[model samples]
Target: MQTQLAVAAYIIHNNKVLLIHHQKLDLWLPVGGHIDQNETPDDALLREIREEVNLEVEILNKLDLPVEGKTKKNLALPFYTNVHSVGDHDHACFYYVCKVINPEKININQKEIKNFDWFTKEELNQKHISENVRNQALEAFKLFEKLTK
Candidate 1:
């Protein structure tokens, strides 16, 4: 089976997480998509967010690695990683938590998303949300809270 690399971000603002109802999948999920060729994970993540929600996000997770000799840039590390089946293929997904730079500037791509909303911690526990997404979103919320404090 073919497995493609993908990146996702849980964008948090004002103690709420941004979720998009994907048109094709018909499921509410974090903003993300397949990592394109020649694009780094960080680039793909930012691009996906822009295409999906038109919001710039600041990744909450950071690698403290020293940049001395060769490369001076350090990409944010993923908070979680998993492989999940999608139709006949699979997605090797890297999960990240982020903070929306401008919450009021959102403009969802209507073709890719059915709707978008912000969910609080209590709202994430609703039965309508998929179990996997709920758990991951909760974790992202916790991480974001800890980082900000």
Candidate 2:
């Protein structure tokens, strides 16, 4: 199967995780998309978040490597990674946890997203939410709590 690299961010704010109702797939999912050429996973993730929700976000994952050279820069590591099918193709997705820099400035791109909302951990257990999304979101929330504390 053909596969593409992708990046996704589970943005948390005020103890809630952000989820978008994808128009094309008709499923509730985290904000993310295919990683473009010459773009790192972190770059793709931040760009996708900006394009989808018009909000700047700070990834909670961080690398503690010492700066050893001028050309080297620290990048946040993905919280999770997985391969999933999309039609006949598969995507190798790098998942990350993030926090909105300005939560009040959200403006969803209606062309791509059907709707967006902030969901509490309890809300993720709703019957409408897909099992994969709910589980990942709950994990993101747990990690976010641990990181912030």
Taking the tens digit of each residue's C-alpha lDDT, what string does model 2 give over 1-149?
99999999999998889999999999999999999999988889999999999999998879777888684777888888999997878999999999789999899999999999899999998887899999999999889989989
lDDT of 1 at 60: 78
Model 2 pairs whose backbones collide: none
Count of clashes, each model: 0, 0
RMSD of candidate 1 to the truth, in angstroms, is 1.0
N/CA/C clash count, model 2:
0
TM-scores for every candidate against the unseen true structure: 0.96, 0.96
Cand. 2 TM to true fold = 0.96
Runs of candidate 2 exceeding 4 Å displacement: none
What lDDT tens digits, residue by residue, belong to model 1 across residues 1-149? 99999999999999899999999889999999999999999999999999999999898788878998899689998989999987878999999999999889999999999999999989998887899999999999889988889
- Model 2 residue 36 lDDT? 98
Candidate 1 TM-score, C-alpha based: 0.96
